[model samples]
Structure formats: structure tokens, C-alpha cells
Target: MTEYGYFLSCEEFTPAELVDQARRAQQAGFTRLAISDHFHPWNDAQGNSAFVWSVIGALSQAVDLPVTTLVTCPTMRLHPAVTAQAAATSSVLLEGRFALGVGTGEALNEHVHGDRWPSFEERGEMLEEAIGVMRELFTGQQTSHRGRHYTVDNARLYTAPEAPVPILVSGFGPKAAELAGRVGDGFVTMTPDADMVAAFRDGGGAGKKVVGGVKVCWSSNREKAVDVVHQLWPSELLPGELAQVLPTPAHFEQAGKLVTRDMVADAVTCGDEVEGHVDTVRAYARAGFDEVYVGQIGPDQEVFFDAYRELVLPALRR
Candidate 1:
């Protein structure tokens, strides 16, 4: 059996606008909401990265949608103790409706603080340590940690929720996935790729709740939707080695040329049409995703929501 729900992808809305979108998504029958938590947009060309925690706080009051950060970097840039406090407070504010999705760190986002991006092995270690710190702080007692990447002294969360926030670890590879299985109460990941799901289960996440999401261009006009998504998210077609070994965004941009509208459609269900979006979202179901979120890339979200509700959701509920 599969449980499917609607989630907002969130690139096209401002921090303030997110509250309204969350409200609308809930009204339209989406059981959950996922927001992209990014320190910076992949490039300056893609604008609108705001303080997401603040947005989450606002959404708590304005909408009933259960929330997650899709994934946050708790190891570097932000101290794990502080991240714990934020999650705890947010969880309380949402009436225990929030979950924390975490990742090691992304260079484009975490490297802005002049911290060296650690090797994958070191990052995996840092992630595990950070999870430990978060759990300690959530206990509502003083927490101290001295680790290779993070250190906190007598830090504690006073405004924690009655229940510790559920930790949903997100990962792309085996090591991180295994860590998530050991630490997370639930698992979160992007893409419908089954191998990634198997790796998470093998890593000890068996029977843990798994949530997944995908990106798409929402438009009634298929060609326009295709053009827009490809123009911005060309990273989809990157060859395996090129994505793994690339040193900078420039190299990424070069390999991104391999992306095309057809490839984007095949990998993700895209278009302004209602049928197209439903087909893409359902594909995640076929791949064993427990929850699949669909994001509308670029700004024009109101139209996307309306079309998705009228055309896509009705078909999906059946």
C-alpha cells in the first residue's frame, strides 16, 4: 500500500508568500508540506532565499499543514545546539506538527561562512555528532559538546515542544543513508529512485516512514513549462562522474547542457497541464515513495496551485 500527499516545492514564492501557499495547499487537501531550506539559491540567477525558519513560524499560525525543511544543514554554519533550539521552538509553535530533515552540508550553502567543506567521510561524522547534540538539547537540559566540527557549552532549549521533534535525515549516498537510519525517527529523500530507498532500509531504516519529493514546471502550456524548468534546473541530466567529481558550479553548468525538456519530462512529470503533473507525481508512488511532494519552479505559483487542485488532485484522489 502507498500513502500519497501533496507538498509544495517552494522556489517561486517569497518568504512571506509561503504562509499563504501553505494555507492554500492544506485547503486543497494536501496532507503535508515540504519547504526547501536553502542558505542561498544555486545561483544569483535564481533569487529568493529568505530566512526559512521565520517563514515556518508564520505558516504555523496561518495554515494547518504539517511542515519539514525538506532538509537542513545542522553540522556547519549553524551550530547543532542552535538548530536544535530552532526545531524545538518551531515544533512547539506548530503544536508538535514539525519534523526536522537534515543533511551533512552543501558547499554552495554552508561554505559561505568561510568554513572548509569537509570530505564526505568527515562530513558524515559531523552529521552524526550534530544529531547527538540536537537530541540532547531537546531533553530540555543543558547540553555540551566538543566535536571535530562543532562545539557548544551548556546550551539548552527552554522552549522545546512537549514531544521531541521527529528527526528525518536526508541523504543521497550509502554512508549518509546509513547514518540516517541509525539516528532519524523517519527518513526523507528526494527523487523516486528505488536504489536509494533500498540503501536507506539496508542502513537500518527498515519500517521507518519515508518521504520523497520531486521538482516540476507547472503550466497549462506544456512547451512553456518545459522551457522554464530546463532553463533553471539543467542539473538533472548531469552524467554520474561529472556530478560526483565536479569542483565548481561552472563545471556543473557545462555538464548541465546534457539536460533537455524530454529528459526533464521523463525524469519528472512536468507541464502546466493537470494530467502531466499527476502522471509525474504518481510515478513516485510506483517507485515506493510513501509521500511525494511536487514543487512549482519559478515564481507564478498561484496558477500552479489552482490548476493542480482542479485537474491533478481530483484525478489523484481516485
Candidate 2:
């Protein structure tokens, strides 16, 4: 069964708003939750980046739904050991319903430490080593690791999870997908691409979960929704490795200027048309995703929840 989830955008919402969304998501029948981890918003218009670990603590109190970091970079900004501690604590708080979604990382969030952003290959190497270290720490036993990128000396997680925190690796291409298959408990990708899912499975992820997320706008006025998305989230339309390489929100804004409203209208599912919303989400399920998270892209969250609760979700569930 494919579980439907709500994605809490740390970059676009305040911590309080995210908690409320999680609560509403649970009430509306979303069985899981995914939250972004970012040091900065993609652009000022998106406008918010609360420390994700703090919000996760609040979420453990606000909702019973399982929470996954839609993705966090454990290799940079914070060491793998520290991220393991945070994930373990979250698991304890969420009563073992937490999963850690990790990735090679975007330079936008990971470059703030004054370290030169590494090549993607090096980042991949760093991530693989980081995962090994974090998994060792998750055992709640004393751990010491010395790898090419990180070193942990006789460290242990005192508050580790009773069960392993499933690590879902995020990737956009085949190489990263293959790495996820080898090292991750699951695979995370934003798009509904069966070929990519196949690549992961072929590489060793056959029985593991495949997770994905999408953003949509639900409104009576379709054009208005497009405008809202264009103004706030044009950053999503950037092609290629731009999302991974951009160093800051300013650079993102500069690039986002190329994303027009028409492009957003064509690319994103918008309006209150129930079928559009249902098809958008169902695409993930058809693509072999075991879980799919949907995020609403504006201020009118109440209506989005109401629509999904009474209409869209029911259709998708059927």
C-alpha cells in the first residue's frame, strides 16, 4: 500500500505553521509527514528556514504521524555523528516513528562552513562514509570512525532509537540511485520516474521503499494559483544540477527569473480540480513509490486540507 504524506516545507513556513500542518495532515488522513532541512530558503520570497531538528521536536508533540526529513545533509554543516544524535533523539520523541532521509546535499546549505564545495563525486564519497558512521551510532553503542571525510572518536548515542532509523537516500540520477540501493534503507526522489526507481531496485533496492514528493496549489482561481507559485516557488523549475550547485538564495533568485508563470502553470498541478490533484499524486504510486508526500504551495492551507480531506484524498485512496 502506498502511504500518502504531507510535506512540511521548512523553507516556506514557520515552525508553528509546520506543526499545525502536521496536525491537519493527520486529521485529513495523511499517514506520514516529510519535512525539509535547510539552512536557508531557496529565495527570500519563500522566506523561512527554522532549524529542522527543533521543529521535529515540536512535531513529535503535535502529531502522531511518522516524520521523515524530506531530506537532510548529514555530511556537511553538521557532522554525521551529530546528525545521528538528532535523528536518534527524534526517533525516541516520535516513539520510533522517525526515518532519516539524507542526500549528498546542495551547496546552498552545506557551503556556509567556509569549506570549498566538493565535486559531486567527492560529495557522494563523503555521504557514503557519513551514512556508515551514522548507522554505527544509531546502534546506541560506542562508535569510532575514521574515514576520508569524517572522524568520530569513541562517540556513542545515549538516546539512540530502540529500532534502527530507516535512512532513505535521495537522488536525481542513476549513480546516486545505485548508491542509495547499496547503502540506504530506501530511496527518495522528487519525481515519479519508474526508470530511476528501476535503477535503484536493480542496484539492490528491490524490497526497499521508494519515496517521492510533489507540490501543488489548490484554489478556485487557477491563474491566481499559478501567480502565487511563480512568485514564491519558481526556484523549483530550475533544470539540471542547478538546484544542487546554487550557492545561495540570491543566486537562486537570479536564476529563478527565467522561470515564467506559464512554465509553472504547465509544470505544477494547480486549482481545485480534484482529478488533477488525484492524478498528480497517483503518478507516484504508479511509479512504484511506496510513499508520496504532497505539499501545498501557498497560504491557503485550510482549504487545501479541507479539499484533500473530503475530496482529493478519498479519490486517491480509492
Candidate 3:
């Protein structure tokens, strides 16, 4: 059976709101929670970016649902050692109900330190090394590493989880999928692409959990929902490496001006039709996802959760 999860958008809500959403998600029958980690909102229109680690700490106190970072970039913005400590603390706080999802990271968050952004190939190499370093530190022993991108001197995590934290790798293409297969405890992506899933399996990911996420806007007014997605998440529609390469929220907003409401309507499930939302989620399951996380794009979260609890989730489970 495919477990259904709820996505907590850190970019769009305050920390308190995110914790409240997690509680509501559990009440609404979501089996797990995936929270995004972003230093900045994709665009100013979305308008919020709380530190994800702090929010996760709050979540530990507020809810019992298992939580995963929808994706975090430990290679930059913060060192892998620091990320290891945060993940370890989170796992301890959650009583072993935490997973780490990592990726190559985007320039929007990474360029903040005034460092030159490396190419995708270089970024991938850095991510692989960072994962290795973090995993070593999670064993709760003194560790030292001298790698191509980072250095660690006598780092040890005192509060590491009793068991190793499961690490999921996010991928969007064949090369990334192969990397995820080779190193990840699980694989994560935003699309329902069977071929990508197959690539992961073929590259040694068989039996590993495959996780996917989708965004939907549920409103009585379809046009208004489309408008909300257009305003808040136009970055979703960017093609190729644009999302990774964009240096700032201002650039994203400038690029997003080209994304139309029609595009969002076509790509996102909008309005009050429960069947459409159900089918959208089912596609991920059919593509062999072990878990599918659905995020409501705007502020109508209560309506979205109520509808899912009362109508959509039951249909999907059947």
C-alpha cells in the first residue's frame, strides 16, 4: 500500500502555522509529513521562509507524525557536519521518526554566502561527499574528513539518533536518479515519472522506497485557485535547470512573470473536484511510489485537509 503524506511548505507559512498544519494533517489521516527547506521563498509573492530545522524542532513537540525534509541542501549554506548535528538532534527529538532528504541544492539559497556557484556536475560530486561525511558523523564517534569540497576536524555528534537516520536523495534526471539509487536509503522526486523510477531501480535501488510530491489548490473558485498557484508557485513551471540556477527570489519573480494561470490550471489540481485530486495522487502510486505527499498551494489548508479526510483519502485507500 502507498502511504499518503502531507507536505508542509516552509516558504509559504510561519513556523506556528506549519506546526498547526502538521497536527491537522495527522487528524486528516496523513500518515507522514514532508517539510520543505528553503532560505528564501521562490518569489516574494509567496513571502515567507522560516528556518526549517527550528520548525522541525517545534514539530517534534507539537505532533507525532514521522517527518522528513522534503529536500535539504547540506553541501552549501551549511556544512555537512552542521547538517549532521541538526538531523541527529531532530531524530532524537522525534524518537526515531525522522529522515533526511538531500539534494544538490539551488543557487538561490547557496549563493547567499557570496560563493561562486559550481556546475551541476561539480555540485553532484559535492553532494555525494557531503552525504558520506554526514553518515559517518551520525555514528556518534569522533570523525575527521578532508574532502574535495569540505573539511571536518574532530567532529562528533553527542545526540545522534540511536539508529542511523535514513537518508533519501532527491533527483530530477537520469544521472541524479542513478546517484540516488547508489547512495540513498530512499528516492524522492516531484514528478510521477515511471521511467525515472525504473532508472533508480536499474541503478541498484530495487526495494528502496520511492517518494513523490505534488501541489494542488482546492477552492470553490477554480480561477482563484489558479491565480493563487500562479502568484505563489510559478517557479514550479520553470523548465530544465532554471530552478537550480536562479540566483535569487527577484530573478525567480522576473522569470515567473511568463508563467500563466492557464499553465498552473493545467499542471495543478484546482477547485473542489475530489476525484481530480485523487487521480493526481494515484498517478504517483501507479508509478510505484511508496509514499506520495500532497501540498495545498495556498492558504485554504483547512478546506483541503477537510476534503481529503472526508472524501479524497478514503477513495485513494480503496
Best by lDDT: 2
Residue 228 in candidate 2 has what lDDT? 96
lDDT of 1 by residue, 1-318 (tens): 455454544444577677777877777667788887766654334556777788888888888868888888897768888789889989998898888988876676677677777777887788888888898889898878887767889887879779888888887777767887888877777767788788888889898877888777776677777777777777656654343345455555666676776887666556655666777778777766777777777666787778777778778777
> Scored by Cα lDDT, where does model 1 land?
0.74
Q: What TM-score would candidate 1 get against the native?
A: 0.90
Q: Residue 202 deviation, candidate 2, in Å?
A: 0.1
lDDT of 2: 0.95
- Residue runs of model 1 more than 4 Å from their true location after superposition: 1-11, 239-258, 272-275
Candidate 1 or 2, higher TM-score? 2
> After superposition on all CA atoms, what RMSD does each candidate show versus the true structure?
2.5, 0.6, 0.7
Model 1 scores worst on lDDT over the 10 consecutive residues at 239-248
RMSD of 2: 0.6
- Give the per-residue lDDT digits (tens) of candidate 2, residues 1-318: 899999999999999999999999999989999999999999999999999999999999988999999899999899999999999999999999999999999999999999899988999999999999998999999998887889899998898899989999999999999999999999999999999999999999989999999999999999999999999999889999999999999999999999988999999999999999999999999999999999999999999999999999999988
Model 2 clashing residue pairs (backbone): none
Name the TM-score of candidate 2: 0.99
